[model samples]
Target: MTLLDLTAPPSRSDRLTALPVAIVGAGPVGLAAAAHLVERGIDVVILEAGPDAASSVRAWGHTRLFSPWRHVVDPAAVRLLETTGWTLPDADRAPTGAELVESYLLPLARLEAIASRLRTGIRVTDISREGMDRTRTRGRAAAPFVLRTQTADGAIGEVTARAVIDASGTWHSPNPLTSSGLELLGLTDVADLVTAPLPDVLGRDRARFAGRHTTVVGAGHSAANTLLALVELSRSAPGTRVTWMIRNASAIRLSSSTEDELSDRAKLGGRVEQAVAAGEVDLVDGFEIIRARRDGDRVVVVGSRRGEVVEHPTDLVVNATGFRPDLSMLREIRLDLDEIVEAPRRLAPLIDPNVHTCGTVEPHGFRELTHPEPGFFVVGMKSYGRAPTFLLATGYEQVRSVTAWLSGDLASASTVALTLPATGVCSTDIGGAGCC
Candidate 1:
């Protein structure tokens, strides 16, 4: 099948060509997919849940990304931007999430080729083949996809497309507070006391942590960033106290400064280590939280360490335990997902955090991202499922290959090419895995 066949008369393989390809989520990867398809003169449309591009990244705008400009910027996107007189940032300089949106995503969305095809504030609630549900597979490939969407104004509507790329990342669905992956007791009553991952402590959200005793849980880079920020807040507001909680016996996994390949990432780890060593931040190791409830204005966190029960009281809690993909909307779609990783079955092994680091995962393209549902793909962080090893660069490579395959360029789709920075140390516990 070729691009030309898509628009041909009602042939066995050309029925789908009547509709444009639809991409869910206007984040970096989704936008890149649009750029690639547009370059090929293929019809494409982008559906974004938020009012603007990269809204999720904007929430963490205060945090600086460890990867430099060169690593985060997509090659295809750069080509499009260059034509509009866009000046690239310093290749070696690391940018905060805000810079990433303003300097790259926003500009990309405004491009003449992409801007006209983009639609914001349109959330995709469900997707399936037109005139056919999951059970009916006969002649499914020829049918266009039906996307159910909810608009910002509360109106619901449907859009049809020849293909779909779901880049709706995991940012909206965060993991629970309990260590066992179940909801903690009394969690509901203290919902307001719990903050999302990547709160801007030193900026807009500073007042929330200024004079309060904050407890931060999890062992990933998100947790590390929060701990560092709280320590900085303590200097200006001496009454503010910060506690770092982890399920591990030791925090050795938190520091890879000396040998880290990325200097910015190393610096973050170094700063976190210094805070712990200076006694500026309380370290609660081996703590497995089981319950949290409101105690007047404060929250009482109860858990166990070893065989002993431990309780801690704090004014606020930041659950930086990472996020999981929202798979509910995809129930009607045929998918072959990994039982554990929740990623595409074929791609799970390559990105399994148990055996691979960010840089070690081999290059993959359309083949790994494709699902049992033809003309459907889940790219970007959502494709990683529960794994914390997804980088912006890796996502770019994924969409690049996916677009090539959709355009019937099988040879280009199979030719994998990507390079990522090593974590320096190997075999860190799953919770401590890091990525861009």
Candidate 2:
């Protein structure tokens, strides 16, 4: 099937233009990369999984990002907007997902940087090296990187490019509920409870949970945002009781700016510290969920905190733990992965939480993951290396590093050797074990 024509095909002169860099996903990071490549005289073809920009924002369309508009907009994208005489929004004002999507993402996609090369409703199912073993292909050898995609029409095809960048974002692959110690509350798999094209909340189903005990799990901004939304839902729907189950006794909330550490303290303090101040939400800290079961109409949750174990009853449960890169599609490929972060860890000492490696290390214990596949780069929150910070500033740095590496504009890839700290067990304490 043919992909939807978001824009007309490039003319003969345009076709003779530079081979477009293939960018996956249309999130802030991907859009930013496209703008950057365009400035460098490189054409770009963006493969976005969503129907359009801001579909993810619309997922929780009603929720506001803890980070302000300035923090989320990519610099390259900003430059393009400036070129078009578009004034940037105030950085201080908190922007909701809907507002961000409508005011920025949608407009950018509709603009020149995106209009011609954008392909919405197309999901990149796989990527791998592709080239003719013998010969007979246009322009040098086959690019070695073939992107397999499925369009909305159910048509399947492939596109080859000189380089590939994965900016698929993180929300698509949510951390498994069981991984966080929460069981399928009612012998019902989390999948069954989840509806495709999942919306953040159910207005009609809102009454069902009224006055019923509901639990929200996780310690990140996403969870915090969800909790905040539920708090508002409980104000008028007072019967809806809310409880937050976090592995860390305290929730770690992030703000837009890091101008001063204290500034972050106030913002994080506002939503997390102050929000908890209200007695409406119960905060269960210092606990890891161990099991979940359906107790008639309610679900029972078991967990351990500090040195003690406890149980709680709830009518509904959501595990907002987090997500990692779904590189499993490339499992057949033998690629070098970081022992620490387990991602294709780059040997560079770059600090970009928008990267997948950062998010992977938090749960999996790996550092920046990298591979020898030249001209290939992956960016965005998925690259956060397990220590998912979910910050746009980190994403900016990621694009900068990736673009430099891809274009061969950097002097050399950065590197540093790290020694693991002692684990308390002495060499003598072990049975003739050697210590490094």
Candidate 3:
């Protein structure tokens, strides 16, 4: 039997008949989707708004993930990495946002799987189905879905596909704390409080904040990280003072109660304890920021805490607030949305049991694809709303289910293959770097 050349490009006319699947946002989810399709011999096209795989991570490059490297690396992606002889990091060690994207995501794209299919620097402006009567030059069947995008070369183009998936992450947009029970503590415009590129408090700029009073608002991982950095900064820059102003009675803790020691809430609680004990930071809880105004060189933060009004003089206000999904692209596609979560209400069922999909060997976050808009799915943190705790493993499962659904093989796809390798009896024998 002769080996087939699977990498040849199809003729231009083949575009009319190619089973095209378009994926938006090239974070872990979109990349996983692309890998899955290629593995199944399906044609896929991935449109990424950024320059590369971890652009979103690069945007928040200054920060590290709450979970370790093990949680962020997609299992199927790991297998693909093994094919290229790359050794993965240990599961216990969490990587920074920059390392996760640069180390894992970019390398996978360079592999034979789905490399040519990726279109970078392509921003998706809108997604919608073309009318059935609309023709490809006046006399053809209307495409099912169209993605309007602007290319890197300043070229505007449209890609029509049988299905579309949105894997854009949390940085789509920022979520103001005011939306989550914090009153305006007198600051009208929150954008001007800090400098751009997001300050790395513990980074080289530690000297700038030293000996100065700083106010941090919000209670998520961002706030926690900010506080931790400030604490470290205070040690060297003894002139810097830190204050964590929260609307809640205390720092917001992680909801997972499964672990007694490793829970995020517990860790954060400890950080708060250390900061308070050191006298470098103050925790002013149960306070609602009422207003803010510039008085010469300092900012006056006024609010009411526990029914008592209070005011504080500050140097800077860092909003470790939160993020929201930028749905501007989906403003055209109509789907059943949850009023509160603002995600697809039907998305829960797809990942509820955590089944696999075809294009990738991971569990997917298909719940975000709740509408009857078959062939479409949403994965990654953006699909989860303001809540965190998404694992890359969950994204892999999502890809498995989605690819299976795409290829019309969902049920059989869930069952992992039991076939034995002819020579490599154990996984380690085949270029064993321990991924087995």
Which one is best on lDDT? 1
Q: Considering TM-score, which of the candidate structures 2 and 3 is the better prediction for this target?
A: 3
Could you list the CA RMSD of all candidates, in the order they appear?
A: 4.1, 11.1, 9.4
TM-score of 1: 0.93
Cα deviation at 294, candidate 2, in Å, is: 3.3
Once fitted onto the true fold, the runs of candidate 3 whose alpha carbons sit more than 4 angstroms away are 1-19, 66-68, 132-142, 151-155, 179-190, 195-198, 204-208, 254-265, 296-298, 308-311, 348-368, 412-436
Query: If candidate 2 were superposed on the true structure by all CA atoms, what would the RMSD be?
Result: 11.1
Candidates in order have lDDT scores of 0.80, 0.56, 0.59
lDDT per residue (tens digit) for residues 1-436 in model 2: 1121212211222332346679988877788778777766677899887888756556655555544565567677778878788876887765656777788888888887687889989988877656432122343223456788999899998987766777876566665554443334444533333221222543545665566666777665555555665777777776877787777646543333444222433354366555677786788887677766666666777767788878777777766766555675454233555555444545333433444222222211112333444445666655544444334554555565555445544432222111221111111110011000
lDDT preference between candidates 2 and 3, better one: 3
Q: What's the lDDT of the predicted structure labeled candidate 2?
A: 0.56
Q: What's the TM for model 3?
A: 0.77
Per-residue CA lDDT of model 1 for 283-397, tens digit only, reads 8989989998899989999999887988899999998887788998888898888999899888999999877656577777777887778788999888988877676677888
Q: What TM-score, computed on C-alpha atoms, does each candidate reach?
A: 0.93, 0.74, 0.77
- Arrange candidates by TM-score, highest first: which order? 1, 3, 2
Poorly placed runs, candidate 1 (over 4 Å) = 1-13, 251-253, 419-436
